[model samples]
Target: MSTIFGIPTPALYGQILIGLINGSFYALLSLGLAVIFGLLRVINFAHGAQYMLGAFVAYLLLNYLGINYWLALIVAPLVVGAVAVVIERTMLSRLYGVDHLYGLLLTFGLALILEGAFRHWFGAAGQPYAAPSQLSGGVNLGFMFLPIYRGWVVVASLVICIGTWLLIEKTQLGAYLRAATENATLVQAFGVNVPLLLTLTYGLGAALAAFAGVLAAPIYQVSPLMGTNLIIVVFAVVVVGGMGSILGAIITGYVLGILEGLTKVFYPEASSIVIFVIMAIVLLVRPAGLFGREE
Candidate 1:
């Protein structure tokens, strides 16, 4: 068999595919975080709980009502988004003018409540969410066997990420969002409904996290604690990507995911800590992060 760097091509390709698949999740989750941070300046510690909620919602929908995955995909996000909207309208909104730390503390409390409730109800066991019938197979690529679902994940995530970026960077609505973040008081004076914008932005970020959870349901065990582990890693991703730049978060998330995957193949022990090491290096070199702008 052909080899690159003395590693079998199939083995190398397989690892790369794993990298890309993981990167897709990182990109989607971080994209949501970036959006909220860009607009509201909230750290959104509850993002992972929302993700776990998405998975649980999907599972509950399936088990209790015989609803399918596709329906859950849409419904779960809407439900989580609504919850997020309520959060913003009630608590987050009032904290907007206060110190950013308050928003963090409030959300962290909310996250604990949500996670505890889920664990109380569901216990620690993870439930399964089978892949949709259409995507439950693999294709033989020249170098290695490729899982269609995994490839589809990479393609779909890239499209979603780019589409979101364009919506925020190129569209008229995006222009308004960008403008609002810079000068909400001025934007409000201009009669743009800044309050509504803030509510919608938070909902959008929560919905994005839920969407990511749906995407991940089949690949990972659907469990209450799942989001807790990933959310911490994503924060690191945000720190490296530059909390100020939306595009930077997306790029750093995916790059780090792939790098982690590659490290798994070459040095399994380092895979766990590689992201933290990169975070340290980046912090030492560029305190604001690669895409972050100093205040």
Candidate 2:
């Protein structure tokens, strides 16, 4: 019977939870984008397609191979990441050191092709992906009930995000990746395989996207258009956080998600555009983004 700011306690808490859940997805997706742009300087427009591909891979594993969610979680990203590797090696490699628009166009074309192909084969309707038995329930937290799977999503995303940040900021390989981006010729001179590093970086970005897709499969319907629905918002999050800023992407995603959720509670009509509005303001005020460095 209690309320906070005139809203019922349960309702307010529920929206906040929803926001956190949404933030999890945003963070995962934008993290991938940030990594790719930061290291490779490529604007990966095919990222959403890669995400959808991961979910579809999981779905196929479940239906055809009888694989469970846990196994698919490990397998889907590897498969999608491998595919990304191939794409980079065969096609994307040639386009480096050119205008970013070229990479964007190539990826955009790939996205269209991927979406079209999946739509043709699977139809536009969403398919259900049931949560595993281990995560098939909810727990009451006095003020609200939290789904076990949803809680798992937030935890998993946080772990992955933190792990990724540490890998890029703390590890030796990360140092090489940063070095390669800044000066590939110099890094290569030191016996590093710059080309291989670039390929792997792209694969890692795709793997991140795929991992997020696997997490999303049970929460949202597994549909070809699923990625299309969320990619724009994720891109907006990256922009607001600052392009190529690993820390910024992670933080901004959660913040924007919570803000969006609060907006839904306070003003339903404005909820959808709130993030974009903030993105526009950020762009005008600091084109480099809240966390991005002005170049």
Candidate 3:
């Protein structure tokens, strides 16, 4: 068996693959966060709950409605996104123009409520979610055995990340969104419904979180607390990437994931806190974040 630095080659590759898988989730979650904070200026503390909601929505659709994984993937995000829209319009919109802390507190409370309700109803145990049949198998990549679903996850996440980047950076609607954030009064005077745009942006952020949850369901058990496990790490990713930086969030997530994976291979004890350490360093060195513009 060939070894790299005394570590088995297969083990090394396996960890790297695992790292990529984790990075995919991080990218998706942070991307949503960046979108919300970047455009809406809302801290959106409830993002984790929204992710959990997505998994539950998928789970419920499958168990009750006989909807398959593929269908649930489409339906879950829509359902969660709609709920987010309603929340934004009826509740979040009121907090606009106030301190960002107020919005954070509000969403934090909502997250607690949602998490508590789900935990009360469905215990703390994780519920299993099966992968689609088409992606159930595995493939050999010479040195490692790769699960099709895992590969799909990485590919899908990359595509989604790139697509979102293009949407915000290249599209006309994206330009309007950027414009509205910069000068809502001007955009509104020019006939754009700024409020509507804000609502939609919040909804889109929630939808991205939901989509990530659906992808995560099969890998991690569907549980009320599942989102809690990942939310902090993702927040760190967003911070390190530069809060509200779309491209920065995307790049930082994957890089941090890979770094964490390598840490596990070398110094296992530091794996859990490595990302946080990096976040602290970034905060001290560049408070605006890696991609955030200096004010």
TM-score per candidate: 0.97, 0.98, 0.98
Best by lDDT: 2
Q: Which ten residues in a row have the lowest lDDT in candidate 3?
A: 238-247
- How big is the positional error of residue 19 in model 2, measured in Å on the Cα after superposition? 1.0
lDDT at residue 232 of model 1 (Cα atoms): 91
Model 3 alpha-carbon drift over 4 Å, by segment: none
lDDT of 1 by residue, 104-185 (tens): 9999999999999999998988888998899889988766898888877788789889999999999988998999989888
TM-score of 3: 0.98
Clashes per candidate, residues 3 or more apart or on different chains: 0, 0, 0
For residues 1-295, what per-residue lDDT tens digits would candidate 2 score against the true structure? 9988899988888898889989998999999999898877888989999999999999999999999999999999999999999999998988887988899899999999999999999999999999999999999987799999999999999999999999999999999988987888999999999899999999999999999999999999899998877898998998899975788899999999999999999999999999999999999999999998878
Predictions in order: lDDT: 0.90, 0.92, 0.91
Report the candidate with higher lDDT, 2 versus 3.
Answer: 2
Q: Which pairs clash inside model 2?
A: none
TM-score of 1: 0.97
